[model samples]
Target: MSRVVATTTLWRPTGPEELALVEASGWAAWPPRLPEQPIFYPVLNEDYAIRIARDWNVPASGVGYVTRFEVEADYLARYPVQQAGGRTILELWVPAEDLQEFNQHIVGPIEVVHEFRPQA
Candidate 1:
């Protein structure tokens, strides 16, 4: 069966002080919602794609490869679940044969966290 790998990048204010400021400003919602998990909104530029391809060791053409992104069960359980906010994590499904190749470029700081295989 084929499998899908989900990836995401997490960004936060640079320092605790910044975080405090963000909180104190009242701009930040109190008792943050569970579904408010961060989202990776890639601009999808040629150069960015190339970098991703290089990092994954796949050919540059692989950059535009479309992959489905969804939230994992655990994540849903932990965070407030909501369909809005593109906050769900990124996901990708690839043939089993391509798994190794994908893995080479996926694992690490990018947060390639889940493996989903189709049921027979």
Candidate 2:
């Protein structure tokens, strides 16, 4: 018999370098955060992710991608959703140390849902 897995959808805004790393993982995991990055944050809404990817990442990198994935709900329960600014700007802050374990809880392959590039 098959069992149902509870999952919560999350979105991440990323640049080409990071996206390449994720692709190298066969879309199964997020690459480890850099030494300066103490936390890995995944947003709770697509709109917020889009804003960051378009307004921030694209300007910085020339290209940005919005990725969507699912994480096992039970594993994610330990981290409370944070409101960065307003009600819609919600995200989960997972410590860099815990990212490996967090990656393991991802329900399936990550997918790029949107891409933003500088207007030429």
Candidate 3:
């Protein structure tokens, strides 16, 4: 018998410094969420990730990164996709404490799909 696996994509927008740190860490998991952060929000699509990586990260940090990874659809069933700011923006809000577990569900290493460096 054959089986099919369902996968869902997730994206994270990060600053170059953080991206470098993540890459150095051997492409395993994202850094631990900050103390005050209630949820670790991973955007649903590349477009939103790029917007943040450019409009936000570039001006503030001089460079931005967009990471892409897939997780089992069943594993992510508990969380709901949220629309914020507008129709094009959607993301998953995973509680900070559950982040490590979330990372475990990721099928493979995270890939930096896009990089944006501010030109001076």
Candidate closest to the true structure, highest TM-score: 2
Which regions in candidate 3 have their CA more than 4 angstroms from the true location?
A: 1-4
RMSD of 3: 1.9
Ten-residue stretch with the least lDDT total in model 1: 60-69
Residue 23, model 2, lDDT: 99
Instruction: Output candidate 1 Cα RMSD.
Output: 18.0
Point out the higher-scoring one by lDDT: 1 or 2.
Answer: 2
Query: In model 3, what are the clashing residue pairs, if there are any?
Result: none
The regions of model 1 sitting more than 4 angstroms off are 1-90, 107-120
Worst 10 residues of 3 by lDDT: 16-25
Q: 1-120 in candidate 2: lDDT tens per residue?
A: 988999999999999999999999999999999999999999999999999999999999999999999999999999999999989999999999999999999998999999999998
Return the top candidate by lDDT.
Answer: 2
Residues 68-108, model 1: lDDT tens digits:
22332332332332333243422222334433333244223
Instruction: Decide which is better by TM-score, 2 or 3.
Output: 2
Arranged by TM-score, best first: 2, 3, 1
Instruction: Please give the distance, in angstroms, between residue 67's alpha carbon in candidate 2 and its true position after superposition.
Output: 0.1
Off by over 4 Å in 2: none
